[model samples]
Target chain A: MARNSSLVFEGRQTQLKPLFPEDVTQEYVSWLKDPGVNEFLEARFKKHTLATQRAYVRGFDQKTKFLWGIFDKKTKKHIGVITLYDIHPMHKYANYGYLIGNKKYWGTGAAQEAIALVFDFAFLKLRIRSISTGAYAPNVASVFNYKKMGLSYQGTFKERLLYKGAFVDQVWYGITRDEWLSRRKKLAF
Target chain B: MSTEERIKSIMADSLEVDRTLIKDNASIYTIAQWDSLQHLRLVMALQEEFGMRFGDREIPDLVSFAAIQEAITKKMKSHGKE
Candidate 1:
């Protein structure tokens, strides 16, 4: 398979490439429908169709939001998706999210590398001051990975998300440009 | 405890399983309780126990008991311990 030449950023283990409409396959739709994959995601609350995914991909714009497919460099397979959304040029900040839809890649640090690449883009190229995100408190992997990536805890909304029959806290996290710069040298590329 | 035993104990504690179930070769696939979330907790526990921070590149290779043992050994050696 040919490498997606439109890769916007490269990391140690994964690359971030533009998510084109054609990249929305049945497999992608299936991932969204997979309860195991979507349980921690808001996407689990809704059904996803290929048509809807295609339209979502087609709606990507760099101004307000940027979506990218997380591709494994060694296997050259698209494993997940990452996005820097709610970008505000005036505020110089954004909120981000990521999903490693492939279970095989979970806990493998692929998400961490993808997150580092996004931070590089947000802080270096786009000159974003602060990048914020949130994770359900019960999602241990998301919480651990976000903290490991140097995102400081901002606050939490009590019983913000109804998950698995109980309401869970939604914890917010963010990292500023200065924070990223100070820690970038130690982080794996 | 030896490095292997230490790793097994950490894994068992993190996954809330009996320590006897975590053999030298036990891995994420082999252990029912060692799911993805537990894996991160295992990593965090290992880090706290060893006082060593694992790089992102090193985290993926630590799925199995032997791998964790080897990684901890290497890290300990680098820190002039063991």
Candidate 2:
């Protein structure tokens, strides 16, 4: 449980380090408040201020929930965040989520590198066997990113979420350690 | 057919578009059919067609027709296919 203290995940373009509550900044809170940014996130429902964002950041004890700031290596700027939560010891699986908070970082491969780093960390470092995540069906970009990441389509939860107007399905994705290991090099994470 | 022709064929087949639409400036961002999902399929197609693999980092950059052509060229050159 004392592991990953000062942990840093080094990727080609992105560098990830554990985020403390104090690391939560005003800009970070604004990312949550931006409707364009949190369009598919449940956070859109909430009023996000510095206090709320810091409290959320403080909740990641790293025993169960882990959080890291995704920094751009070249600029050393915190571009977004990635998290692995709800770790189950016996089951050896965890749920994953990420956001490229800085819109300028979008489509710059920052998101992909951030995802690959966390997945590698969970599978290889944490010794987790499987990692899973879900996306709104209308979020075609997210669904497809998971595909390129080598995660298998697990299933669909029908009408699982309300989008702009009507209900939409939620698509689940998952990958096991062996599956990731086999593909990582060729995929070059 | 030549390697470039074959590459275009795979792109056309995978993206369900005419081979001619894959022009010099044709790009994943510009093409309606070349979404993220199709991009993966297109990458797979290129890999199968060229018998080469792209690094995970390279995959995202291989968006444009010219970029993909360049990647394949470099890979082919490394393998002496060029």
Cα lDDT tens digits, model 1, B3-77, are: 777888889899888988898778754564554567778889999999999864456457678888888988889
lDDT of 2: 0.82
Each model's DockQ score: 0.10, 0.09
User: Per-model C-alpha lDDT, please?
Assistant: 0.81, 0.82
Output the lDDT of residue A37, model 2. Answer: 90
RMSD for each of the candidates: 10.1, 10.6
Model 1 spans > 4 angstroms off: A1-7, B1-82
The digit string of per-residue lDDT tens for model 2 on A55-163 reads: 9988999667889999989899998999999899899999999998899887667777788888888888889999999988777667767766778788989998998
Q: Indicate the worst ten consecutive residues by lDDT in candidate 2 chain A.
A: A1-10
Kindly give the stretch of ten consecutive residues in candidate 2 chain B with the minimal lDDT sum: B28-37
DockQ-based CAPRI category assigned to the predicted complex of candidate 1: incorrect
